[model samples]
Target: MRLRIKREDLSAIERHSKQSFPLECCGLLVGRRTGTEFEVLEAVPAENVKRSPTLFEMDPQFVHAVLSRAESRGLTIVGFYHSHPGVGAYVSGKDAEFLKLWPGVAWLIISATRELIEERRAYVYEGDEIRELKIEVY
Candidate 1:
Protein backbone atom coordinates (compact mmCIF):
# COMPACT_ATOMS: atom_id res chain seq x y z
CA MET A 1 0.00 0.00 0.00
CA ARG A 2 1.00 3.62 -0.47
CA LEU A 3 0.18 6.99 1.04
CA ARG A 4 0.35 9.76 -1.58
CA ILE A 5 0.53 13.17 0.03
CA LYS A 6 1.29 16.63 -1.18
CA ARG A 7 4.73 18.07 -0.44
CA GLU A 8 3.22 21.00 1.46
CA ASP A 9 0.99 18.88 3.63
CA LEU A 10 3.90 16.68 4.57
CA SER A 11 6.06 19.73 5.25
CA ALA A 12 3.46 21.09 7.64
CA ILE A 13 3.35 17.82 9.52
CA GLU A 14 7.13 17.77 9.75
CA ARG A 15 7.24 21.38 10.91
CA HIS A 16 4.67 20.67 13.60
CA SER A 17 6.66 17.70 14.72
CA LYS A 18 9.76 19.86 15.04
CA GLN A 19 7.94 22.71 16.79
CA SER A 20 6.54 20.30 19.35
CA PHE A 21 10.16 19.38 20.13
CA PRO A 22 10.64 16.83 22.93
CA LEU A 23 6.89 16.44 23.37
CA GLU A 24 5.11 14.26 20.86
CA CYS A 25 3.02 15.94 18.19
CA CYS A 26 0.00 14.32 16.56
CA GLY A 27 -2.46 15.01 13.77
CA LEU A 28 -5.08 13.58 11.45
CA LEU A 29 -4.44 12.33 7.91
CA VAL A 30 -7.33 13.50 5.82
CA GLY A 31 -7.68 12.08 2.31
CA ARG A 32 -9.35 9.43 0.21
CA ARG A 33 -8.26 5.91 -0.52
CA THR A 34 -7.92 5.01 -4.16
CA GLY A 35 -6.82 1.66 -5.52
CA THR A 36 -3.69 0.79 -3.55
CA GLU A 37 -2.95 4.32 -2.42
CA PHE A 38 -4.24 6.58 0.31
CA GLU A 39 -4.26 10.01 -1.34
CA VAL A 40 -3.58 12.38 1.53
CA LEU A 41 -4.91 15.86 0.96
CA GLU A 42 -4.31 17.42 4.32
CA ALA A 43 -2.48 16.86 7.56
CA VAL A 44 -4.73 18.45 10.12
CA PRO A 45 -2.91 19.23 13.35
CA ALA A 46 -4.44 17.94 16.55
CA GLU A 47 -3.81 18.53 20.20
CA ASN A 48 -1.79 15.82 21.91
CA VAL A 49 -3.61 15.47 25.17
CA LYS A 50 -0.96 13.20 26.61
CA ARG A 51 1.77 15.85 26.22
CA SER A 52 4.36 13.16 26.74
CA PRO A 53 7.57 12.51 24.91
CA THR A 54 6.94 8.79 24.60
CA LEU A 55 3.21 8.63 24.07
CA PHE A 56 0.57 10.61 22.26
CA GLU A 57 -3.18 10.64 22.62
CA MET A 58 -5.20 12.79 20.28
CA ASP A 59 -8.00 14.67 21.97
CA PRO A 60 -11.26 12.76 21.55
CA GLN A 61 -13.31 15.89 20.88
CA PHE A 62 -10.86 17.07 18.25
CA VAL A 63 -10.85 13.71 16.58
CA HIS A 64 -14.62 13.75 16.42
CA ALA A 65 -14.59 17.24 14.95
CA VAL A 66 -11.99 16.38 12.32
CA LEU A 67 -13.93 13.31 11.31
CA SER A 68 -17.09 15.33 10.98
CA ARG A 69 -15.44 18.06 8.95
CA ALA A 70 -13.75 15.61 6.60
CA GLU A 71 -16.99 13.76 6.00
CA SER A 72 -18.76 17.00 5.23
CA ARG A 73 -16.01 17.94 2.80
CA GLY A 74 -16.35 14.58 0.99
CA LEU A 75 -13.10 13.28 2.38
CA THR A 76 -12.22 10.35 4.61
CA ILE A 77 -10.09 10.15 7.68
CA VAL A 78 -7.47 7.92 6.10
CA GLY A 79 -5.13 7.67 9.04
CA PHE A 80 -3.00 9.68 11.48
CA TYR A 81 0.44 11.30 11.85
CA HIS A 82 2.65 11.70 14.88
CA SER A 83 6.25 12.33 15.79
CA HIS A 84 8.42 9.96 17.75
CA PRO A 85 10.78 12.48 19.24
CA GLY A 86 14.30 11.09 19.82
CA VAL A 87 12.97 7.63 19.05
CA GLY A 88 13.05 6.37 15.47
CA ALA A 89 10.02 6.08 13.21
CA TYR A 90 8.66 2.63 13.73
CA VAL A 91 5.49 1.36 15.29
CA SER A 92 5.96 1.07 19.02
CA GLY A 93 4.08 -1.58 20.99
CA LYS A 94 1.47 0.91 22.13
CA ASP A 95 1.12 2.29 18.61
CA ALA A 96 0.58 -1.20 17.18
CA GLU A 97 -2.31 -1.69 19.54
CA PHE A 98 -3.73 1.70 18.65
CA LEU A 99 -3.65 0.76 14.95
CA LYS A 100 -6.12 -2.05 15.61
CA LEU A 101 -8.89 0.44 16.22
CA TRP A 102 -8.43 2.02 12.83
CA PRO A 103 -7.78 -1.21 10.90
CA GLY A 104 -6.33 -0.44 7.45
CA VAL A 105 -5.75 3.25 7.99
CA ALA A 106 -2.15 4.40 7.67
CA TRP A 107 -0.25 5.51 10.76
CA LEU A 108 2.48 7.97 9.71
CA ILE A 109 5.28 8.28 12.19
CA ILE A 110 7.95 10.96 12.03
CA SER A 111 11.30 9.99 13.47
CA ALA A 112 12.48 13.36 14.70
CA THR A 113 14.96 15.22 16.82
CA ARG A 114 15.74 18.87 17.49
CA GLU A 115 18.45 18.57 14.85
CA LEU A 116 17.09 16.11 12.32
CA ILE A 117 13.97 14.50 10.92
CA GLU A 118 15.41 11.07 10.23
CA GLU A 119 12.47 9.24 8.73
CA ARG A 120 8.78 9.37 7.90
CA ARG A 121 7.26 5.95 7.93
CA ALA A 122 3.68 4.83 7.57
CA TYR A 123 2.21 1.54 8.73
CA VAL A 124 -1.01 -0.35 8.62
CA TYR A 125 -2.13 -3.15 10.90
CA GLU A 126 -3.83 -6.15 9.40
CA GLY A 127 -4.59 -9.37 11.21
CA ASP A 128 -1.57 -9.80 13.49
CA GLU A 129 1.27 -7.80 11.95
CA ILE A 130 2.17 -4.20 11.30
CA ARG A 131 2.78 -3.66 7.59
CA GLU A 132 4.83 -0.76 6.29
CA LEU A 133 3.30 1.34 3.56
CA LYS A 134 5.29 3.35 1.05
CA ILE A 135 4.84 7.11 1.18
CA GLU A 136 4.77 9.24 -1.96
CA VAL A 137 4.99 13.01 -1.78
CA TYR A 138 4.41 15.18 -4.83
Candidate 2:
Protein backbone atom coordinates (compact mmCIF):
# COMPACT_ATOMS: atom_id res chain seq x y z
CA MET A 1 0.00 0.00 0.00
CA ARG A 2 1.02 3.59 -0.50
CA LEU A 3 0.35 6.53 1.82
CA ARG A 4 0.57 9.90 0.16
CA ILE A 5 0.69 13.07 2.21
CA LYS A 6 1.21 16.71 1.43
CA ARG A 7 4.54 18.24 2.32
CA GLU A 8 2.86 21.02 4.24
CA ASP A 9 0.76 18.56 6.17
CA LEU A 10 3.85 16.56 7.03
CA SER A 11 5.46 19.77 8.18
CA ALA A 12 2.42 20.47 10.29
CA ILE A 13 2.81 17.10 11.96
CA GLU A 14 6.41 17.90 12.70
CA ARG A 15 5.45 21.18 14.25
CA HIS A 16 2.74 19.57 16.34
CA SER A 17 5.12 16.88 17.48
CA LYS A 18 7.70 19.40 18.55
CA GLN A 19 5.12 21.50 20.32
CA SER A 20 3.77 18.52 22.23
CA PHE A 21 7.13 17.15 23.25
CA PRO A 22 8.17 15.63 25.52
CA LEU A 23 4.64 14.33 25.24
CA GLU A 24 3.18 12.48 22.32
CA CYS A 25 0.94 14.17 19.75
CA CYS A 26 -1.97 12.48 18.02
CA GLY A 27 -4.09 13.36 15.00
CA LEU A 28 -6.29 12.10 12.19
CA LEU A 29 -5.49 11.88 8.52
CA VAL A 30 -8.50 12.98 6.53
CA GLY A 31 -8.51 11.97 2.89
CA ARG A 32 -9.67 9.52 0.25
CA ARG A 33 -8.58 5.97 -0.39
CA THR A 34 -8.54 4.22 -3.74
CA GLY A 35 -7.36 0.69 -4.21
CA THR A 36 -3.98 0.49 -2.45
CA GLU A 37 -3.43 4.22 -2.12
CA PHE A 38 -4.39 6.72 0.55
CA GLU A 39 -4.30 10.37 -0.37
CA VAL A 40 -4.18 12.52 2.74
CA LEU A 41 -6.10 15.75 2.41
CA GLU A 42 -5.59 17.05 5.90
CA ALA A 43 -3.82 16.31 9.14
CA VAL A 44 -6.25 17.11 11.88
CA PRO A 45 -4.65 17.44 15.27
CA ALA A 46 -6.48 16.02 18.26
CA GLU A 47 -5.87 16.36 21.94
CA ASN A 48 -4.04 13.59 23.71
CA VAL A 49 -6.17 12.95 26.77
CA LYS A 50 -3.53 10.60 28.12
CA ARG A 51 -1.09 13.56 28.09
CA SER A 52 1.82 11.20 28.61
CA PRO A 53 5.11 11.05 26.82
CA THR A 54 4.76 7.38 26.06
CA LEU A 55 1.01 7.12 25.62
CA PHE A 56 -1.73 8.91 23.67
CA GLU A 57 -5.50 8.70 23.63
CA MET A 58 -7.61 10.92 21.43
CA ASP A 59 -10.96 12.29 22.55
CA PRO A 60 -13.77 10.31 21.02
CA GLN A 61 -16.03 13.35 20.92
CA PHE A 62 -13.38 15.27 19.07
CA VAL A 63 -12.96 12.34 16.73
CA HIS A 64 -16.68 12.28 16.11
CA ALA A 65 -16.62 15.94 15.15
CA VAL A 66 -13.80 15.27 12.76
CA LEU A 67 -15.68 12.36 11.29
CA SER A 68 -18.68 14.52 10.61
CA ARG A 69 -16.57 17.25 9.13
CA ALA A 70 -14.66 14.86 6.92
CA GLU A 71 -17.83 13.24 5.69
CA SER A 72 -19.28 16.62 4.85
CA ARG A 73 -16.24 17.30 2.74
CA GLY A 74 -16.46 13.89 1.06
CA LEU A 75 -13.37 12.73 2.85
CA THR A 76 -12.84 9.78 5.12
CA ILE A 77 -10.61 8.78 7.95
CA VAL A 78 -7.79 7.61 5.79
CA GLY A 79 -5.42 6.99 8.63
CA PHE A 80 -4.04 8.09 11.98
CA TYR A 81 -0.79 9.90 12.72
CA HIS A 82 1.14 10.30 15.92
CA SER A 83 4.52 11.21 17.23
CA HIS A 84 6.95 9.30 19.42
CA PRO A 85 9.07 11.88 21.10
CA GLY A 86 12.68 10.85 21.53
CA VAL A 87 11.88 7.34 20.38
CA GLY A 88 12.16 5.58 17.06
CA ALA A 89 9.28 5.46 14.63
CA TYR A 90 8.00 1.99 15.38
CA VAL A 91 4.79 0.56 16.73
CA SER A 92 4.70 0.22 20.50
CA GLY A 93 2.71 -2.19 22.64
CA LYS A 94 0.11 0.44 23.42
CA ASP A 95 -0.10 1.39 19.77
CA ALA A 96 -0.57 -2.25 18.81
CA GLU A 97 -3.57 -2.54 21.08
CA PHE A 98 -5.09 0.60 19.60
CA LEU A 99 -4.57 -0.75 16.08
CA LYS A 100 -7.04 -3.53 16.79
CA LEU A 101 -9.80 -0.96 17.02
CA TRP A 102 -8.89 0.67 13.70
CA PRO A 103 -8.47 -1.69 10.82
CA GLY A 104 -7.87 -1.09 7.09
CA VAL A 105 -6.36 2.31 7.72
CA ALA A 106 -2.86 3.61 7.54
CA TRP A 107 -0.92 4.18 10.74
CA LEU A 108 1.74 6.82 10.39
CA ILE A 109 4.28 7.28 13.16
CA ILE A 110 6.79 10.09 13.31
CA SER A 111 9.73 10.11 15.66
CA ALA A 112 10.69 13.55 16.81
CA THR A 113 12.34 15.60 19.47
CA ARG A 114 11.93 19.14 20.73
CA GLU A 115 14.40 20.28 18.12
CA LEU A 116 13.61 18.25 15.02
CA ILE A 117 11.81 15.33 13.49
CA GLU A 118 13.87 12.17 13.25
CA GLU A 119 12.06 9.69 11.09
CA ARG A 120 8.68 8.64 9.79
CA ARG A 121 7.21 5.20 9.19
CA ALA A 122 3.79 3.99 8.12
CA TYR A 123 1.83 0.75 8.31
CA VAL A 124 -1.50 -0.68 7.29
CA TYR A 125 -3.71 -3.37 8.78
CA GLU A 126 -4.52 -6.28 6.52
CA GLY A 127 -6.04 -9.64 7.35
CA ASP A 128 -5.32 -9.31 11.07
CA GLU A 129 -1.77 -8.29 10.38
CA ILE A 130 0.03 -4.97 10.10
CA ARG A 131 2.36 -4.37 7.17
CA GLU A 132 4.69 -1.50 6.44
CA LEU A 133 3.78 0.85 3.64
CA LYS A 134 5.65 3.05 1.21
CA ILE A 135 5.09 6.74 1.86
CA GLU A 136 5.00 9.43 -0.82
CA VAL A 137 5.16 13.11 0.06
CA TYR A 138 3.81 15.57 -2.43
- RMSD (Å) of each candidate, 1 decimal: 1.0, 0.8
lDDT of 2 by residue, 1-138 (tens): 899999999999989999999999999999999999999999999999999999888898999999999999999899999999999999898778777778888999999999988999998878899888899999
- Badly placed stretches (over 4 Å) of model 1 are none
TM-scores, all models, native as reference: 0.96, 0.97
Report residue 130 deviation for candidate 1 (angstroms).
Answer: 1.6
Q: Distance (Å) between predicted and true CA of 52, model 2?
A: 0.3
Candidate 1 lDDT for residue 56: 92
Q: Encode model 1's per-residue lDDT on 33-88: one tens digit a residue.
A: 98678999988999899999999998788899999999999998999999999888
Check candidate 1 and list the clashing pairs.
none
Least accurate 10 contiguous residues by lDDT in model 1: 124-133
Q: lDDT (CA) for every model shown? A: 0.91, 0.92
Output the TM-score of candidate 2: 0.97
